[model samples]
Target: MTTTSVNQDKPLPGKPGVAPTFRWAILTLSLSMLLPALSTSIVNVALPSMAEGFSASFQQVQWIVLAYLLAISILIVGVGRLGDIAGRRRLLLAGIAVFTAATFLSGVAPTLWLLIAARAAQGLGAASMMALSMAFVAETVPPSRIGRAMGLLGTMSAVGTALGPSLGGVLIAGFGWRAIFFVTAPLGLLTFVLARRYLPADGPTQKVGRLGFDYVGMLLLALTLGAYLLAVTLEHGVFGTLSLALLLAAVVGLGLFVLVERRATSPLVRLANFRVPVLSAGLAMSAVVSTVMMTTLVVGPFHLSRALGVQTALIGLVMSAGPVVAALTGVPAGRMVDRLGAQRVVFVGLIGMVVGSISMSLVPVSFGIAGYVTSLVVITASYALFQTANNTTVMTGIRADQRGVISGMLNLSRNLGLLTGASVMGAVFAFASGATDITTAASADVATGTRWAFAVAAALITVALGVAVGSRNRSSSDRHD
Candidate 1:
C-alpha cells in the first residue's frame, strides 16, 4: 500500500521505517488516551468519599469533575492546531508527562481546592492527548488499515470510559479514594517511556499566512465557557443572581470571541467550514449524542445504587455493558460508514438512540436485572454506531490541512456535551428530589430524575435526527450538482 504525504514539504515522521513498530506506538499512545478517559468517570464514584474527607459541599465536589471538563473543552481545538504545526508526537509525550505529574499531585492533595487545581492541570494534558492521538493514527497507519485502527482506538476509549467507575469503586472500596489517581501513575510512566522510545519525531513547519497565535480570542473563549459552566453549576443554589450575571458574561464573551476570530490572522475555529451542511450538522449531532449518552452514564449509577439498592460495583458492571457493546460495534460502524457513507449510518444510529432512550425511560423502578441490562446494551450499541459515523462525517468532509483544527473542535463538542448533560441531569435530579437529602430519597428521586433526563435526551435526539436528515438531502444535492 502506498502512503501519501499529507504535507509534501516535510517528510512524514513515521515513514515505512517506523511502520514495523506502528502497532506498539499505537498501543502506547492509546494508554495515554485511556488514562485521561478513565480518570473522568473513575473520580465520580469517589466524589462522596472526597466530600466527606474534605468536609466539602456537593458543589465543591462537583468542581473536581467540572474543572477538568471545562479546561479540556476550551483548549482542545487550539492545542490540536498547535500539534499539527509543532508535531503531534511532541505534544503527546509532553501531555503524558504533565498528566502523570498531575495524577501524583491529585493522589496526595490535602484539600479539595488543591485536588481541583490538579484536575485542571490534568485536563490540559488530556486535551493534548485527545487532540493528537487521532491525528497520529491517521498519519501513521496505512489507508487500508485506518478503519480498523480507528475502530480499535474507539473501542479502547469506550472500554476505558466504561471501566472507570467500576474500577474506581473497587479501588476505593479496597484501598481508598486516593488509589484512583495512584493506580494510573505507573501506567502513565510506562506510556511515556514507550512513546519516547518508539514514536517518530515530525513537526511540519508550514508557512501559514499571517500565522500567529490568537491569544485574545482563546482567552475570551475560555472565559465564555467558564462563565457558562459556572452558571450551570449554580442552577439550584441561592446564587441565582451570580449565575445570571456569569451567564450574561459568557454570552458577551462568546460574541467577542466570534468578532475576534473574524478579524484575527489565525483563528482557533475556522468559521468558513461551517458553510458545509455536513460539518455543521455533524458537530451538532456529536454534541447531542454526547449530551444524551453522558446523561445516561451520570444518572444510571445513581439510580441503580440509590434507587434499586444495587452496589456500586454491580452498577458499574451493568453500566459497562453499554460501552462494551459500543466498543465492539465501532469497527462495524466505521466499515458501514466507509461502504454506505456517513449520513445514512448516522441517521440510523440516531434513530436507534431514540429507541434506546425511549426504552430506558419506560423501564420501571422494579424492572428485573435482565430488563435493565437489555436497556443498557441497546443504549451502548446506539451510541457506538452514532459516534463512529459522526466522527467519520466530520473528519472526512474537511481538507487535510484543517484536520487538526476540526478534530479539536470535535473533541470540544463532545466534552461540552458531556459537561452540559451532567449538569442538566444533576439539576433535574435535584429538582425531582425536592429538598430531601439524596441518601434518604435516593431511590425515588433517582428513578424519577433519570426517567425525566432520558425523556429530555430522547427529545434532543429527535432534533438531531431532523438535522441529520436535512444534511443527507443537502449532501445528495451537492453530489448531483
Candidate 2:
C-alpha cells in the first residue's frame, strides 16, 4: 500500500470548528439528506393524476414510485462501498449533480415509461446521496455530540417526509404536477453548491492493491429483488408463469450472491457483523418497521379517495399528519433512547404501533373522514417513535469503520421491506375486493382488505415487541458480565 499526504488546508475529520463555513457545510449535507427523503413520498399523492394523464392502469402508475425505490434498494450498498473506496465528498457532489439533472428529465418526461426511467436515474443519484450523507455526518461530528447530530438528521428526514405530500399537492394544484419534480432541481443545485464550498475532502485516496468491487453480487441482488417484486404484481396465466420463473431466478441469484460475497476479498456486506446481537435485532426491527410504514403510505391515499371520498389535495393534508408527528417526536425519542435505553424506547414504540393499528382496523364507514384522520394520526405517531428509536440504536452500536456498510444495509432492509409491503398489501387488497378498481359495491370490500392489512401490521408489530423485550433482557445480562 502507498501512503499519501492528508490535506492540511481542509478541516480535519471529527474536529470542531467555530467557523461559519463549517456550520454551512453541515447544513448542506443535512439538506442533501432531506431532499431524497422528501422525494420518496412526494410523487405518491400524484399517482392518480399521473395515471389519468398517461391513460395507464393503477399498477403501471405504481412503477413511478417502485422504480425509484427498487433502484435505490439495489444500489445503496454498492454506492456506499464505493464511497468508502473513493471519497464521500466526491460521491455526495456527484450524486447531487446527477439528481438535479434527473429531476429535470422527470419533469419533462412525455410518457409513463420515460418518467419511470427518469425516476430510476433519480434513484441512482439518491443512492449516492443517502449512502454518503451519514458517512459525512459520522466524519464531521465529534464522538460526544454524534448522537445529537444524528438525532437532528433523523428529525430533518422525518420533517422532509411529512412535508412531501402536502407540498406536492399544493404545487400540483397551483401550477401542475410537473412542478413537483422541478421544485427539487433547484434544491439539488443549491445543495451541491453548499457541499462544494463547505465540506472537506476526506475519503480514501490510496489504492488498496487488488481490491475488487462485488459486481456479481450487485447484479444478482438486483435480479433477485426485481424478479420477486414482479412476481407479486402478476395476476394470472402466462404472466403468472413468467412471474414464478422470475421469483425462482431471484432466489437462485440471491444464493449465488451470498457465495460471491463470502469468497470476495472485499465484500459489499460483511456477513460477520450479524454475530452482534444489537446489530442483528436492530436490523430486523428496522426491516419490519419499514415494511409497515411504507404499506401505510401506499394504502392511505387510495383509502382516503376511494373509500372515504376525500379530495386528492385534502388527502395529502390528512396524510401529512403522520410524518408531522414523526418529526415532532423524533428528537424526544432520541433523547429517551440515550437516557433510558434503545430497547425500552423501541418496545414502547412497537406497543404504540400495535394500538394504532388496532385503532385503524376499528374505523367504521359511519365514522367518516374525521374518524379516518384520527386513526391515521395515531398510526403515524407510533411509527415516528419506532423509527427514531430503531435508527438511533442501529447507528450507535456500530464502529466507525463499519458505519458505511451498516448504514447501507439498514437502508436496504428498509427499502426491501417497503417493496414487499406494497406488493403484498396491493395483492391482498386485490384479492379481497375481487377487482383492481375500488368503487361502489367494491368500497366495502376494499375496507375489509385494508382492515386485514392493518391487523397483519398489528401482528407484525407485536412480534417486534417480543424481539425488543428479548433484546433488552440480553443487554441487561451483557451489562452484568
Candidate 3:
C-alpha cells in the first residue's frame, strides 16, 4: 500500500493540503466536537426531571441516553463509509442539519417515546460528525502539526465535558429540562453555517473514487452492534436469557459481516486493516482507557456526594477538575507525542492512570477533598496524554482514504468501553454496597463500593499498560510510525 502526505506549506483555500482557511476549519471542527461531547454528559442532569414530566420510570429515562448511544454505535460505520463514498463535507453538513433538527424536536417533545426517538436521531448526526471530524483534521493539517490539531479536538471535548453538567443544571433550574436540548441548538446551527462558509471543498487531491457501498456488510455490522449494546444495556446480566440471545445474534452477525466483506466489491470496512499491530493495539488500549475513565466518571459523583458528604455544587466543581486538567494538558501532551513518539507518551499516560487509580482506591473517608482532587487531576491528565497521542497514532496509521471507517471503529470502541464501564462498575458498586439499590445506601457502604470500583479500574489500566509495552517494540514496523 502507498500513502502520501499533504503539503506542509499553505495552499489556496478549497484546494488540497493545508489551506489558508485551515484555522477556521479547525474552529468548525471544534464546535462539531463540542456539541456531541456536551450532549453525551449534559442530559444526565435532566433525567429525573424528564422522568417526572413524562411520568416515566427511571429505566425509561435511561433510554434517553441509551437510545443515543445505541444509534451512534449502530450507524457510525455506515455513515463513515457514506462519507468516503459521497464526501466528508457533504455528510458533515447533513449531520449538522439533522442534529439541529433533532435538538429542536427534543426540546418540544410531548411524549417520552418521541423524546427517545429524537435522541436517537441526534446520535445519528453525532456519529457522522464524530467519524468525519478527525478525518478532516488529518486532511487539513500538515503531518508535523497533526498532533497539535488532534489536541484541539481533545481540548474542545474536555471543555464541553467539563461544562455540560453545570450548564445542564443551570438550564434545568432556570427554565426546564427542555432547555438542555434547546440551548445547544444554536451551536449546531452556527456550526452548520460556518461549515458551509469556510470548510474546504473535497477537491481532486483527496477525491474518493468508487461510490458502491456494501449494504450487506453495513446491515450485519449494525445488527451486531445493536444487539450487543442492547444486551449490555438491558436489565439482565450477561448470562440472562435475553442477553444471551442478543449476544448470540451479535456473534452470528459478526461472522456474517466478515463473510460478506470477503465477497463485497466495495466493502464497508477493509478487513485487512485489523492485521496492523499499531492500529489494533491502539484500539485495544483505547477500550481499556475508556473503560477506566468512565468508571470514575460514573462512580465518582455518587462517591463524592454520599461517601465524602460533599455538597451538590461542590461535587460538580470537584468533578469538573478532571476535565479542566485534561483541557489544560492536551496541547502540551500532543507536542510531546510529536517529539518523543506516541509509544513513549502513551507509557507516561498509563503510568499516571495506574498511580491515580490506585490513589483513588486507597482514599479513606478520613482523607480530605484535596487528596481526591489531586487523584482526579492525575487520572484526567493521563487520559489527556493517552487520548491525544493514541488518536494521532491510529488516525495516522491508516491510509488517508480509510480514516472515515477507522474513526468510526475508534468511536465504536469508546462507546463499547463506556457501556462496559457503566454496567460493570454499577454491578461492582452494588455488590460492594451489599444492595442493588445504591441510591439509599449508607455512607460507609458507598465508600466501600467506590473504593472497589477504583481498584478494578486500576487493574484494568495496568493491563492496558502491559499491552502498550508489548506493542512498543512493534511500533516502528507499523506503517504510519
Best by lDDT: 3
Taking all chains together, the TM-score of candidate 2 against the true structure is 0.86
Give per-model TM-scores. Answer: 0.87, 0.86, 0.92
| lDDT of candidate 1 over 1-481, digit per residue (tens) | 0112222233336444443366566677567667778988899889999999999898889889988887788788877887766667777888889989998999999999999999999999888888777767666665545555555667778878878888998999999999999998888899888887767776556543336766787788888988887776666433478888997999999899889989977777778878788889988988888888877777776777777788755776777777779877877776776677666778788998898888888888777567667777877787887787777667663665567778888888887777677677666665665636666664676777777777887899999999998988897899899
* Model 3 lDDT per residue over 320-410, tens place: 8988999888888878887888778888999999999999999777886888888888999999999988999889847756888888888
Question: lDDT of each model, Cα atoms only?
Answer: 0.77, 0.75, 0.84
Residue 88 C-alpha lDDT in model 1: 70
Task: Give model 2 RMSD, 1 decimal.
Answer: 5.5
Off by over 4 Å in 1: 1-20, 52-58, 206-210, 236-239, 305-313, 364-366, 428-451
Q: What lDDT score is found at residue 137 in candidate 3?
A: 78
Q: Among these predicted structures, which one has the highest TM-score?
A: 3
**How does model 3 fare in lDDT?**
0.84
Judge candidate 1 at residue 354 and give its lDDT. Answer: 91
Q: Once model 2 is optimally superposed onto the true structure by TM-score, how far is the C-alpha of residue 163 displaced, in angstroms?
A: 2.9
